[model samples]
Target: MKLVGKTAIVTGASKGIGYAIADHLMTHGADVVITARNEAELATAAKQLTEAHTADKTKAIPVAADVSLAADITRLFERAVEELGPIAILVNNAGNSTLDLVENLPETDFDAVVGTHLKGTYLGTKAAINHMKATGTPGVVVNLGSVETFGTTRGNAHYSAAKAGIDKFTEVTALEAGRHGIRINAVAPGAVETPMGQDATTPEFTAAWHRTFSVERMGRPADIAKAVVFLASDYAEWITGITLLVDGGTHLRGLPDYADFLLPTTN
Candidate 1:
């Protein structure tokens, strides 16, 4: 119960990596506010979380909002303070991606991908930092990054760009917020078996990808979740501004050829 009295807000927590982060936070005795664009899914996640953690008296509040919108981000923080307490942690894990070559990708697609990943992280971090500063709380912010940021993966130019931005953003924000006693960092996952990951690649691709990992297995959402929990905990009091790669040492080997599986093969 490292986070017994702390309250957290996790964006895009309806499912996948986001959901796993919330679960782990609650496991450590934090009251969590989970947000996503899908109302039904968010509610379901909240119910499951509440039921699962009833013994710990940890509450999970679900708010339906699009993190890319500033208005929604404001409301999310407000709700967290109103319903739970001062926000001690913020996880900017909401993201969406469309695979396509740079030239083939549409402008709107680029905007959506970048907006949700990069812009959403910015908005959520800004709100969390402001709230923490005002409340005199030394909170932590964990932004979601990707191993792709450090390597090339064709058909994911936009995704890689946004994640790379997040890496730098986390560092700069950590520098700015550190003086205020707030810590900001990022977790970069590689080929996690989430719905998004599965949708982006096939079994064949996953098999080949796993073989490249020193761990000899694909990542699980829980693996990333555990890393987030560690960074958010007091154990990492001196850690900030770094992008922690929780990719089972996959970064050491570089990313797989996603284009071979995602893009159409022309004979």
Candidate 2:
């Protein structure tokens, strides 16, 4: 158990990639506080993780939070420590995207998507660093990024910007926090079949996405989770400031056309 006796906060853990990450952390012996906007779903997710993976139900706590909001994120970080222990790891796994081209993208929709991913990740990073520095304990942070940061995601500029911002945020923060015994990194996933990837998971889209990778099958949440686990563990003590891409070699290839899904055809 690489993470045994550690405590962590995993945002956006209600479903999809976030849930898988939370489950993986707890199973590997971390006390985790899972958060999402939906309280019921968050509760269910926490219950599922504890019941299935831990003898101690206290190992997992469900907190309802909208990571876009500073208040909610602050509460989540504090609660993790108050309920479990000092924060040892944080997975900034909360973010969503819109299916709209730059011209058609609504301002509100753009704000919502960008705020949740970029601002949210920043807030979580600050919180993690605060706790780590205060306690003088080594800490790990894993921010969720996308291959779209390097590759193009036509008609999805906001999502791409936010994820790209996350990569830069992870890098600079790692540089600043490394001296404080904190390791910050990002995981850039490629075309995973998660709720976030639902917009681009059509048969046509799948074929297009598949062409970017040597791997024949679509990516899975578990695939990303394994990478996060390894990064969060002492096994990666020497690793920091880089994004570990669990992209099945897809990042090396060009991105598929997102216009067909994100843009509306006009007469």
Winner by lDDT: 1
Instruction: List pairs with backbone clashes in candidate 2.
Output: none
Q: On residues 54-156, what C-alpha lDDT tens digit does candidate 1 reach at each position?
A: 8989989999999999999988888888999899999999999998888788999999999999999999999998999999999999999999987897888
- Estimate the overall C-alpha local distance difference test score of candidate 1: 0.92
- Each model's TM-score? 0.98, 0.95
Residue 95: error of model 1 in Å?
0.8
Shift of residue 79 alpha carbon in model 1, Å:
1.0
Q: What local distance difference test score does each model get?
A: 0.92, 0.87
Which residue pairs clash within candidate 1? none
Number of the top TM-score candidate? 1
Instruction: Return the TM-score for candidate 2, rounded to 2 decimals.
Output: 0.95
